[model samples]
Target: MPSRSLTDPPRIAFAGTPEFAARALEALIGFDCDIPLVLTQPDRPAGRGMKLTPSPVKACALAHGLTVDQPDTLKTPELRAPLVEAAPDLLVVVAYGMLLPRAVLDIPRLGCINIHASLLPRWRGAAPIQRAIEAGDARTGITLMQMDIGLDTGPMLAEHVVDITDIDTTATLHDRLAEAGARLLIDTLPDLLAGRVTPRAQPDHGACYAAKIGKTEAALDFRRSASELGRRLRAFDPFPGGLMSVDGTPIKLWRAEVLAEPGAPGLISRVDDQGVVIGCGAGSLCITELQKAGGRRLPVAEFLRGHALAAGQQAQLPG
Candidate 1:
């Protein structure tokens, strides 16, 4: 690619879905980037009414009166034509939820770049934020990468590191990473377009794919350690949630603390205003925040007011 004059703003095409990508698009608009086209997934049914709703990226584009396209796939020449016609110097992909095959990748002048949620070549696939937390990693970061045919096996343009806190859930970590990526993209874009920065290849070692989180995995298995169970609750919060069943009624666990006191695994050792203390294989887990199925999440104190839990009761995986 030819070096760009710093005075000339590059024509960029944006592709993404969900709020994470929307944040980056918003940043670009604020920066006055010359974005010619925006691509997002097609509208899908959402909420209780199952009404068709545009993705967050699409909504942002429309609100700004930018040209927006929702292509189901980019495999066909027809579907990829709009991107080619835009003549973009760069294509920024952020959580777009669609794979861009090789044909689509060659359209940009400076080439396609991705803003990934985790530090590559670690946690390289879907659900990186939650997986990092679940795996008890002390740090997770945003990687700005040069896109390749291989999944996230791309050369790094830049990266911004963010530390993970013990209390962080997927929701909290996601928000932080989104903002970091947006900042990193704008900061690096000027130099990148001017051909001032080199793309560093990712190492072949220590790569891991983050498989998508499944609702079935939310069922808390007390056979695990207290720390593991606590992390699971935090990792899955604001989604499927950590599940525990008492007398066939499924309760979702939102926040928990690992404790030293222990009993038989899956046995409820104590039930009080403090919280519900249940035994794991190695330690005890204190359920601090929880909710009944179809109910709002509540503190343990508030939850116990309307529910019955007793010491020595066995907690089972939700069926």
Candidate 2:
């Protein structure tokens, strides 16, 4: 281990990717500790032009003048050697896409701890934020846990819950969780380093996986209940956005509200300055915000000003 006096704050090595992880890294920068290194996913092609983009965590680490490593796999000895050489007292992970093998996990004196986006044993997988909103969960939060071999089946250190509001989309919920998690991590670290906090094994009950959201799931099905479809529109915001075919032209639904009106599913029941009321199997949905293919997102009143979608028309599911 790197030479250090007991009075010094713990030496930390952080590994993470994405904006959520970057937020936690930002919090750590303000702490009274030595951050030996930061490990983030490698840059990848993105956007309409497909230009190479560095991950949010990598960019943040660089801005803070911290050493950064973007290895393809940490399991290999050559790659793992540098981490062991750093001799971090603790390893902090947040949304790191790749799993750390047992060899690497054993390197840190205090072992690896993760700031997961969901309560332990619930929504434990790749896409907790999106999964919670998609599942219509009333609430979700962050969990600080001791990492192990199993997927998020680790012992819990701390947890903080946040309520899910009606207006909350995936984008909104994600920001809340990120901030809440950052605060929780900072508060828990001191206790953790002093051996005051005890790790509790997570119960086997209430386990569910939050699988990665697929592009295919974007296609909206009017056959489902309006309430469920409305939730989906909020869940998939700024992602594979909720999709529907209007008179054979593809349109994206951004925000919607359920209505009590009943009519044939998929058929347009009403079109006014208010919104587009589309029928569902159970009830109806008022699509207040929408966007046509190759057009800007607009309120229903503005969308109807140019392109026309009237009653008797239908929004069809893409095949």
Candidate 3:
């Protein structure tokens, strides 16, 4: 742990939810800094029973015996009072899933800082990790910025990039970026406290918003090139996984490899222990892992044992 000899460690109020945010919070705790309060989204219905479940951040905070608040809306004056009461010198937001109105941003003495998943001025909106991977970018990383009212328009304090491997899935990339962001935050906090690092304005020219990934976007379209579908397969893995329909049944694709071949789109060109190679518009995709709706995820050979998928069978995918 880096030792600081300031008059006092700045009071920090963290706002976030999900695993990514939890990682940041954990890093802050490990630094032995003062965390007065944590704000996370309210627990909501999840999974089969649709029962309300606390976010991972909330659970982690409680386990650490830290104070936590779950406010549905921060736009109102009444709801914003608690944040003021916390009297945080700095506000750090990460994957909070809610927009911060100007009032909340102005509450902290040092202003609010955000841990964004992408290199800002690039994928500026939500779902940056998924969008970067889906676009098949060679690299993506984390950015620490001073928050502004506009969406992720904050000036950047620091950034660190990581290469995107061919096999890197959304889940894998998300974890790596989160860890990287946490380290960057720790390294930059001293400069922020000393008022040494000036936040630089982001270039407006290359700004692009990463729209939230939709459930329907997970369905793989065979009419598209194998490389395109392959990117989607990697981008949506572990959540809203890529899918294709065969005989009106939905098959979730978890792992796949692109191959050079030509045949009718959606046609099963080959079937082997590795997987069923399905033809695409330009090439083919060998699906290694898959799952049927209401069925367990299985290897290609195991899935083939229960469900008959032979060569020459036509598969339909959503557009």
> Candidate 1: misplaced stretches above 4 Å?
1-8
Worst 10 residues of 3 by lDDT: 1-10
lDDT of 1 at 22: 100
What's the TM for model 3?
Answer: 0.96
Question: Per-residue alpha-carbon lDDT of model 1 for 26-125, expressed as tens digits?
Answer: 9989875688899999999999899999999999999999999999999999998888888898999999999889988889988999999999999999
- The order of the candidates by TM-score, greatest first, is 2, 1, 3
Q: Which order, best to worst by lDDT?
A: 1, 2, 3
Give lDDT tens digits, candidate 2, residues 1-319: 6467889877899999999999999999999998999999989999889998999999999999999999989878999988988889999999989998999899999999999999879999998888888888999999999999989998999999998998899999999999999999999999999899999999879999999899999999999999889888888987878899987798888989899888789999899989899999889999999898888899999999988999999899975
**How do all models score by TM-score?**
0.96, 0.97, 0.96
Task: Using lDDT as the measure, name the better of candidate 2 and candidate 3.
Answer: 2
lDDT of 2: 0.92
**C-alpha RMSD between model 3 and the true structure:** 3.0
